[model samples]
Target: MAGVESAFPTKRLSVPTADPQPSFLVFGAPRIEEAEIAEVEACLRSGWLGTGPRVAQFEQDFARWRGVTPSRVAAVNSCTAALHVSMVAANLEPESEVITTPLTFCATVNAILHAGLTPVLADVDPHTQNIDPAAIEAAITPRTRAILPVHFAGRPCDMDRIMAIANKHGLVVVEDCAHAIESEFRGRPVGTFGDFGCFSFYVTKNVVTGEGGMILGRHEESIARARILALHGMSKDAWHRFSDQGYRHYQVVECGFKYNMMDLQAAIGIHQLARVEANWQRRRQLWERYDQDLAGLPLQLPPPPEPDTRHGYHLYTVMIDETRCGIGRDGFLEAMNTARIGTGVHYLSVPEHPYYQQRFGWRPDQWPHAVRLGRQTVSLPLSPAMSHADLARVIEAVHGLIPA
Candidate 1:
């Protein structure tokens, strides 16, 4: 397919680079400072490292940051864990259908399937590459019980329309906020709009805990249920059982997975959460630089946020036009690698994966927008750890490699 140029294109800039960069620029290195190091050290010193006070504090602090009550948050091992527990809390019957976007990481769909629900893929919007609310509404059927919308590349989906459709259909809404810790829709955080918001703190996500996640909800009962489910369905978590008061016995209430986040991870999260906004500011500046520097290239930069929305700027993704750029997306990635600049693909559309294709018999052409984006999209390195020189190297490498 031909590359689609931006409507407001600028003159291309020429940057000369005789040699590849001396050192490889990794795509998503966690920005670990003295504070993160000290916090983790403190956890090691404390010895109450397994799902203890630090995890409790992180959850409380996260809830306060999101303007939700502390009881509304449940800390887990990964966003996948959060999503799975949220689905279980939703109490949907086995084989119930979940309408979701195809333009997300497989974990989003995998959670649905793991929860014994059918994943019904909805095509994405051509511009935002987000689940189109119209497509979601169209895909809903009598068997549909939930809607899982991913905030792709940290851009918030059209929640107003999605919420309206979900409300009209009486469907559960589980928001996949893996890339959207800093994203907001009309002043409200992305996760707060849905019935349950699942957030990631993976190495590459906006916030880094190495590997952790949180689930946010408004209802106390559901949040309590998620808390129990996250820790193996125990009547009492270890933190409560072995507290200074006494050793309390715990009973298994139901069969559940061990998805609790450790205090060691939460120690990192506590500090990461503290500086997330500042880190987001840095990423926003870098995103703008990429926008200005790569304006006229044979690429489609990520869409800007709509009015009144705040983008997380988690991943600076661009779609390559092979014909115009004189290279396919994979070729572009290799070229970037040769220049010692690391890059990534946010995802291939869920149905395009071999597992999904063979299991569901999904065709790539069924969701044309998702298929196209999946084929063309490439994520440039965008992280708080990136220095100004690192940004310049990436910009220069991109300009030098893509044909004018």
Candidate 2:
């Protein structure tokens, strides 16, 4: 609460700024183009639509993007699966403690639970909306085996500091890069600094794969095991086992899950990854435009990206404190919906959810910064698919909704 500002001085609009657009503007809509459509069509026609050539190609392309070798990357079904499989592949001991940010999506914590490890939460920095390095340091314990830091809103966490802390304590670093495909810190890519970096390609993600994820690991052996663990722990995946050359026999060496990415999903991801930079630039433009247009309003726009770091430009989130803006966060969301515009709350602090609160016996007050930020934060429409006119409508709606 000390770091979060609940009020800001600004004026209210006397009348509506503009009428709502005829069609609803979807939030976080990915820019799916003809290239993706064509690739998907080609995949369907090829008939190898499961875990096959396309998924392998996507892994190679993603590895190149992250500056990692193909052997160090594995494509999975979702970031959640990536995180879980990575943890299992890392050989973390049962009941070990994993410290992570409380301000992230529940999947970050659930992955820890699914891995048979206990999750420990550290508060986040309200300004950067990232896991505070100091909080992570304080959260360490004798049983602590790793730290999972989410790059909230696509802003890279303080990896330099986080990795340093991990090194000091001999803890594994697993980066939750769900919002950070194109992000970097101090000239290094995000997933490279950690032992394992998990990425998301959900429909609304910077790179849309309908539903897919990738793991970028530092060690080849660990990543190879991760690949095995992702697809039923078999000695050979389906493609290798039943190729045109021969029908090879296989063995199940370890218990695993059905988390492998399908060729169909990878088909879309391939084109999406190819256009990642172009899409990021478009989102960056939209983000800057929003900052400029909404500066005069009573809202807390995202802080500027740190110097020497490349923000992924994933989600453009703003804090809408009721005391300052005369409208609660939910009220603003409803108002946007009524205006035929979609919006989102990036998250409610992990403790705010009933399941987590009950399971962990946690309370919102334990992480005051996360609770405060989560309650007031709203994700605006920052998709690369949006046109200039769409952006204008969002800004006008925000300006028009200010209570007098």
Candidate 3:
């Protein structure tokens, strides 16, 4: 597979080398094309780098891709902003608890705090690495206002069970879809199952917009309010206020944050969104190859995608337990870096971080599975931009690291 040409056009950053030291492979490198470059250049030339037509176009494109109406989505600066705004728009009571998985990015928890709500941790399933529905049910209290379920690593959480739990408890559902743009569960997209679905377009994400996100809402009014809240709570956005027709007066409906997505970022995202399917296919190939090559290594590979579910294949993670692999997780990271290959730790469970511990009196022991998985998890490179030679280099480096 090393020398085989890929079905998609190669976006190689470097050629295979005999040099003991070569260019360090950056994890999560985005696959950028000439179309994106041209669109960005055009956007710069238009003198409308702020939130404008490009942002509007990107939002429409994304909404269509997600099988929703244009009015159902609102673009923002980051997934963090999306989460924060969604929670605010949902009208969750201040300081009311929002249940979420421990095995997710801090932004998920922090958004609840930003929205003036308490974030309660629910332990994840050891096998699925997603928030267990039972844990969510067990964590719910009279004050629990919402459920924030992250589609961790692009695997859709058991949405049917989760929705059932949310429905039973009458809790609002705000899906953290930062890793699940292309994920679907049981023939339906992941984000649609919740009241509000938040997605990311960070530089390393499946869609590269430098820094951008979008919110999908079940109700038009909620999405419209989110749009207003995203841009300083103004009744009229900049695009409408200063369009070619004429300047229009606007009113500030409520105090809000500056979370609007810029046209410059949207320019890159428009083309990226167009190529999403092709890129997803490329990533699927790489994921399958990784499974094949990494087999028999003393590591715990991610389980197969679940039935009736479409995984986003965002990260190819493996748990390197020292007792079996003869190398600690941190040591494996160091070895990979020494070999000029890059890797990532998807996360260190929320409670493991000191800020959460000090603020909430939480401990890793409370969520043992998340803590253990966090300690051993390593995200190997998985990007459409990677060449077969690059794949071979990573595999060779990993094979060389483990003891016989």
Candidate 4:
């Protein structure tokens, strides 16, 4: 459970010598402003509220922004739905296995279960909190049908290694990109790497629409299948049906569910997407300040991307090894809370969930790396809403709590 060291520790951080203090704090607030609200109101007034022009435009815009064709993107109501649709498109057989990280949100694994795939817990590399790519080959077996890799906390996984293993094993790749909106890996955006990339626009995400998601597929057919799975399995073009040239005939070609994105949400999303770039810049500056300010602090700062990638700053997390910090993560959080500062845990290892434990019978020691992460990690507030004073207060609190 060793943590990675940062390069500029001398100038970036200092070990705390006193108790900390923070008057206020925030985490991942929506970057949208009044214009976003106006967009939604326009949609409301338009009266075509359900999966209509606005939703279609959102899907089209999202695809264009991602540099993918429109047919390769399917807008849905939740990342969970996007994942569910992706898993179905994967055509996984019942009881087939999918290897995924334990240090992700439950939705990632639950999507596998909902698709009737057996979820296999893979321990993370403590350094990255990403599924250890090396362990994946060992986890693969005849029953393995897919590998779902989550870009944890907006940090892209080593896609090259993961993809290589998937190709060798003939397993499908479904990336859980719920935390990563514009995250990149090796100079390419994250959602573009895998067979299917599922994104969440939950209130807390980098590009959110209150509640919605998008699935980016690698192939037109695969993307089309996802659309079918999302919209009650209607195979015909849902759009052309109502036009004069459109035919009345349609077919329920597949067994599917309704996971369509509503016009209202899409309206909100159009504006959120525009502000993401600017919000990301401020996020980078704030993140750098946190690292620099806490450089010599007792615990290690989270490592930056390895020169070839960009983190979306979804969560400004730092790892605390009690042995180094002289306090465990829980105690440190308590101290921060007492100082009127707020904090959050991104997740514990996914396998620790009751359903997984009962079904997989996995143990904490089995994924030692993920277990260690759950024990030692804490999420510092990082959002565009935070002011300079708020940032300073967080630094002050952390510096105060570290034992000299």
TM-score of 3: 0.95
lDDT for each candidate structure = 0.92, 0.93, 0.94, 0.86
**Which residue ranges in model 1 land beyond 4 Å of their true spot?**
1-21
Residue 248, candidate 1: how far off, in angstroms?
1.2
Higher-scoring candidate on lDDT, 3 or 4: 3
- Model 4 lDDT per residue over 1-404, tens place: 33545433657566777755434455555667898889888888877677878888898889888998999999999999999999999778898999998898888888888898888877888888888998888888889989999998889999999999988888899999998988999989998888999999998888889999999999898988899889889875445465456576779999899898898899999888878888889888999999888887777678887778988778888888888888888998888887777788878777667877887787878988888788788999887877898889889888887853
* Better candidate number, 1 or 2, judged by lDDT: 2
On TM-score, the stronger of 2 and 4 is: 2
lDDT of 3 by residue, 263-358 (tens): 999999999999999999999999999999889798899999999999999999999999999999999999999888989998899999999999
- List model 2 lDDT by residue over 177-285, tens digit each: 9999999999888888999999999999999999999999999999999999998899899999888979999999999999999999999999999999999999999
Strongest candidate by TM-score:
3
Give the TM-score comparing model 4 with the true structure, all chains together: 0.89
lDDT of 1 at 374: 91
Model 1 weakest 10-residue run by lDDT: 1-10
Q: Candidate 4 overall Cα lDDT vs. reference? A: 0.86
The candidate maximizing lDDT is: 3
